[model samples]
Target chain A: MADAYESLTDHEDDARWAYGTGFSDPLAGVDTTVPSGIDHEDLAAYCLMLGDDALIMSHRLQQWVTRAPETEDELAIANIALDLLGQARLLLSRAAFVSGSGDEDSLAYLRPASQFRNVNLAARADADFAHLVARLLMFSSWRLALFDRLTGAADPVLSAIAAKGVKELTYHRDYAAQWVLRLGDGTEISRGRMRAAVGDLLGGSLVDELFAVHEVEERLAGVAVSPGGVKEEVLSVWGQVMRAATLAEGVGTTAPAGGRPPPGPPPPPPGGGGHDCAGGAFARAGSAFPRAGWA
Target chain B: MTSAAASTAATVAAGVADPEMPMLTLGDLGILRGVDEEPGRVIVTITPTYSGCPAMQTIRDDLTVALRAAGYREVEVRTVLTPAWTTDWITADGHDKLAAAGISPPGPAPRRAAGPVPLTLVPRASAISCPRCGSPETETITPFSATACRSLHRCTVCLEPFEHVKEI
Candidate 1:
């Protein structure tokens, strides 16, 4: 509306919001001039990895905008998408600072596909309804675990983002877990498809475990984070969710190797394949549906 | 940076707390990021808690009226999409407000999340202890609050039901 007006001068000179004054630098409590004793580049890159994952996932989730199976589901999906978008914004901003480049909007809209560092899981489009549930359940479990660890990161900004993310991830996990249980325990058709979906998660390259924090972790020693290390804890909780819901436990109980450093980038995490249009990963698996035909 | 203007403006802001979580003012929620006055205009900048919070419009409208009622002419409010707001922004006072409102605020905003405490889970603080009874025995009957500000929680110890301000 302001742009449609006669001149740029007609619009208010202030960049601040007129109707929504919610983002008043919530980090006012901390000395945000710079994170204390942390490598900005590594922190920024780490943030990008997490941010891009959330951004892509949010983009992918937006496909369900009006096509959700039910009205409640539509709201739920939008809610989840918004949550992801929120994470993306925070992470992207953090990354922009680290990289000394553009801010969130510039990075989100300008970056090409390959430039994005989100694991394949986030980039993968929405699959069939059942597959979407599987991907969400798996991805949420993994990310929730990662964010859970990031809440203790050495960087104040990253810690702040992670602290906020814990709430959102908890919701995402709960929502996806509920869907998995419903589909797994519902009708015969639902049950069968759910089984296949769960089975697909077993060995999709992400089977071994993954950790991209090598540079960051090594630098900060105790400050950096590794999603790969918490694989067991995450899987254990995820397994319980599945078992409690009566789904066929495709994964066995993993022993708790708590506090061990994660191995090298082990494949991508779950959700890295099934709907990957970029890589040839699941090209042959489910031609039953086109690549995210939701549109 | 007029002290008189800021004091009056802050009072107007005092009327504007988070719509979803009424216990904390927008200032307390850390969502009411910054306020600026130029010529005859007042600009209030906000960051949405989530992209599609159903009450965003309500919050927007309330900000407008709150500023106008506070006696600011040509008031404007805008929502910033970047630097997403987080639970860590919830101030210590905000936590107290949530607790007073019967919602257990998030545990201390993780200081060093890279190696945070393991039992990490931050919900809406729905598992809040009852303000009346101080028991960690509460249940959320409805996720969405009646006023888009408070959820209905029933406490077991006091056998009393109350409204808990939903945490952002």
Candidate 2:
């Protein structure tokens, strides 16, 4: 058997052993023609929205690498982060290909925070493990539902990406859901923390933004999934999981009145209106296809 | 080029082992799609196991090296995305190879129905047996493991920890 680890040290191109060291095109050699009737600009913008979400959320998960409570948890979080990062690379590459803009690196790193099109939930720092799992449970469930529908997207590349994502997201959503269950039912202290985490997220306006309809989603029709459409099914699944874990009912389905809102939304994208997903100023306030990133 | 030349290139490409799971060849792993030969150039097609699979680059490099050493002037590795890869593609021989390496081979890939995927709070019971003791009484230690494609598990009878290739 090849000593895979040992061989890495002796390999001539040892510098390229780790991920991110050598940046080859993730979608190299695949036919990237935009499907007929799909506006390339709209498609590129849509890719940024989804790609930015995965990229930013992946960053959030990566923060847990060395700090997770156990070695197993660290591995799990790191793997999940890697999956999201992989999805981010593909989506960002597609966006760049369609937009005639910079490559994935420039789109991911060169842009300022205000230019990122991710939702507020992805950008927030996890207060603790409970908060992390709570956010993960919601994020994975929502993304899984969206990707499930995207398998039939009008764009073949998007459809292919979503098809592959469905399998991985299945594992991700289940991982977070199981953690919520364990933490929510473990001990008095653990249950309190889990409940508080769920409450803070659900009671805030950021959760509502996940379900809001964005203009790009409206224009893309069959090619994109409106977050609003999947909200019901996602909530239903979350409700079942929360109930089993003995958390409060009706928490994440909706937010309470006078709840805390995120920061204000950035100015609309060029040629777009004032229909940003986040109503107020949030660290990341752009809608699904907000033009702030482009500006 | 003659079919004989293409056959030789295919044999070389097929023998390249996976970087992570060295026991399985690229063919056994089901990532190698096709091998075509021209006068002085050969084109090889492969599909990634995952979008973010880090091993893809290494796999490409390994295939190119193996083919070039076999007297090919040039080698081109292409990737395909349609009909995304599934663990079900692992050949019958691949399953035996994984078992021999102390890793549990995946069972049949789950066939999904049309519409929304149902959410389950707990893991669905899978028919995975221990590779070492051949005991069926094994439980998953964690769904995520050393690699994106595997899960950590422990056997109750033999009490040995092993990795199981996930059924995607």
Candidate 3:
């Protein structure tokens, strides 16, 4: 450890994982040159959209730490959080590389809430273990499907990142699915809690936010997979898991129609279910996990 | 000026132990891809074990430091992502070292299939032997542990908890 004076002169130590700064450039050594036909701006934006989702969701999951019911389960959730954090770092670094702008740190910490591209669900607080698993199930299902398709994206870097992510996301989805089943099909009280969690988290136009295609996705045709493209696949897995858990497929309410973001940039209006609303500020404010409260 | 310099640099770089698992060298772990020497500079290409493996920076720093100590003034450690790393890359000696250290080495990695990953409620049962007792009666306590590439398990025979290098 460096003293205050030494710390000022030697910033290298600041980058250590514990210090939160000096992560080796996640994309270092990997060729980041934008392919001939792809637009750098569009590629950057697309990366953020996915990166923010992972970053925000990872932060949310980290809140579970010691709060998890079991020691092993706590480790599992923390592992999942780390996996998503790694993915977020890669994607954000990719974005910074192509955009000719700030680096991963700047993009993550400097951006305003309105500028954050994650779906709202990623940032929402979970009520309990059931809600956490329910959200994880939905989030991982969509992301896993999207990442599986992204393995073949036109951009080499994106393709590589997605291919690696597929393996990690598989474990994440499996963990969530297992928990959902355990709670939803167990004793009546457990079943009721699981069902209520699904209804509260997955019900109401919230999920539609995941499928709504944004302009950045529209612009980056081959380079990006539209969220809408993976909708059916994500929904299928969700339905399968829900039914097997003995929970209602829809859990009661369907996503309200007519809330889809209007195409073109400037991002969806704030009211847009998932992608809009709380930005980085909302996430930052919530990051101070009250340990006492959890205990 | 000679190819021998590149091989020497490679030797030095490869000899550096993984910060997390000192029992294994980067070469044994299959992360040290290659070493190219030119004039006064050496370039080392390596791959990460996992996407979020926090040890990447330390590995990079260690490689640079090792190469520099071996008389190279300029060293560059490059990370490659394609041909994503798998436990299968761990060398024979690496596995032996892990077992000797009481950490069960990984089995064959699960082969990935095309299309969306099929969701399963139960972990696929794998044949893991006790590193301490060599009993094939080990069960997974959880699929995750202190790091992304390892899982927690307990040997029913010896009743000892151990970390297994996960099959990616």
Candidate 4:
């Protein structure tokens, strides 16, 4: 073993060591070729939004690090978070490179809440593991649709990121879906919890999805993910998944969220934990991705 | 053998399995970070397939051995864990290697999870030219591939669903 060390010690200017540093041509890369349409600035903003989602979600997932019910679950949550973090790092780094911002650290640590444009879905942490799965299933499917469209982004970098994310999202959705089915249909307690989780997690934050902040969407409309391209389809996918799981559990496909008409019109029922009891209310909007500090 | 080779020298590449997809090799995914050869030891540097990937240690072990077989005998592998890895690391050639293995090549999407890594429930055409047919007309069959680094895709013309190596 010492021989290996000594041998390596003699080899200065180690290319291998250099490779790990991620040094490379920022503009010219395998995924750098821009498609016919795409505004560089829009691409930058789009990347920032995506990076923020990953970074924030990863942060939430990290909270579950040692608090999981089982060892496997602990590792599973952590792993999932790590996956998101990895994506956030790359996306943010790419965003910084394009925007002339610093890097991932600056964006992740320095930015405040409102600056982050990620959907509330990612920003809101679940009250329980099952809630997490319910939220994850919906979020994953949406992302899959987005990534699928992004694969063809006008910008090579965006396209490349989407291409890879398509695969990861698929699994992320599937894993969450599986859990959704399992928990959603498992037992009375499990089902009740699943219902609560779904209700708690299913607040619509479509405004973020409907509008495109960066010009990238317009520039890469045909090539990169276009607004509204996969939204409906992905929603269908989630619905189908939820139905399938519900059917498997021998339960009605859709029931009033938690067996009651969600809080609408009228106000909370005097401190009964009603209305304000996490039925319709969701997270406050904020900035999850800021300019990165250092790469 | 030279003292460089014999003086407790060990070369090992972190053989970390890509976290998203555990089956493929880091080389296949193009995320084996770096293979460092130091005197008396070899240090393998690797970034997770996803920043939050569950199995970075395995990659480190694999990298360690890769170097050991090549030349060095002793090994010390470390996870760079910073700057992270991305689909950009998946080389054009590496994509082919993955495809040839029937493992699907990654593209367009950086195979590794990136910041706020966007997910896809729907897919549009990306520049993922089919590795088998070199046709850009490909569709994503499954957003998730058999493994994390790969997304299941089918060449429209070929009518075959193949694995695409994610750029991560």
Give the candidate number with the greatest TM-score.
Answer: 2
Q: Cα-based RMSD of the predictions, in order? A: 9.9, 7.0, 7.7, 12.7
- Give the TM-scores of the predictions, in the order they appear: 0.63, 0.88, 0.87, 0.55
Query: For this target, which candidate reaches the highest lDDT against the unseen true structure?
Result: 2
Write model 2 residue lDDT over B1-168, tens digit each, in one string.
Answer: 449889999999999998889999999999998899977899999998987799888888888878888999799998888789999999999999999999999999988887678676878775799999998999888888999999999999989999999998
Q: TM-score: which is higher, 2 or 4?
A: 2
- Model 1, range A1-295, lDDT digits (tens) per residue? 4564445344332223332423322222333445566667777766776787787777767666666777556666666777787678767876776678777777777765545666655554443465567677777778877777776676766776776677667667766777777787777666665665555555354333243334544566555666568777777866776776577454323221222222222223225444435333222221222212211
Can you list the residue pairs that collide in candidate 2? A263-A280, A263-A281, A263-A282, A264-A280, A264-A281, A264-A282, A269-A291
Cα-lDDT of candidate 3: 0.80
Candidate 4 on A1-295: residue-level lDDT in tens?
5766675555433333423323222222233333444565666677887877777676666666566666546655665676687678668877777777676677766765556656556666556677678767867777777776677555666665666566556667766777787777677667766766665554443334433334445554565455465656766666766675573342323453445433222222222323333222223443232122111
The interface root-mean-square deviation of each model, in the order shown, is 7.6, 1.8, 2.3, 10.1
DockQ of each: 0.15, 0.62, 0.61, 0.11
Summarize candidate 2's per-residue lDDT along A1-295 as a digit string, tens digits.
8687766666566435643247688888888999889988999989988898888778778777777888888899999899899899999999999998899999987876667788777765566687788888889889889988898899888889888888888888888989999988788777766776787777666677788777788899999998888998988988888888988564444332323232123222212323322323323444433432243
DockQ of model 3 vs. true complex? 0.61
Between candidates 2 and 4, the one scoring higher on DockQ is 2
Ten contiguous residues with the weakest lDDT in model 2 chain A:
A262-271
Per residue, candidate 3 scores C-alpha lDDT tens digits across B46-132 of 988878888888888878777777789999888888878888999999999999999999988787576667788777775889899
Q: Higher lDDT: candidate 3 or 4?
A: 3
| Cα misplacement distance, residue A132 of candidate 3 (Å) | 0.5
Q: Which candidate would rank higher by TM-score, 1 or 2?
A: 2
The TM-score between candidate 3 and the true structure equals 0.87
Q: Model 4, A120: alpha-carbon shift in Å?
A: 1.4
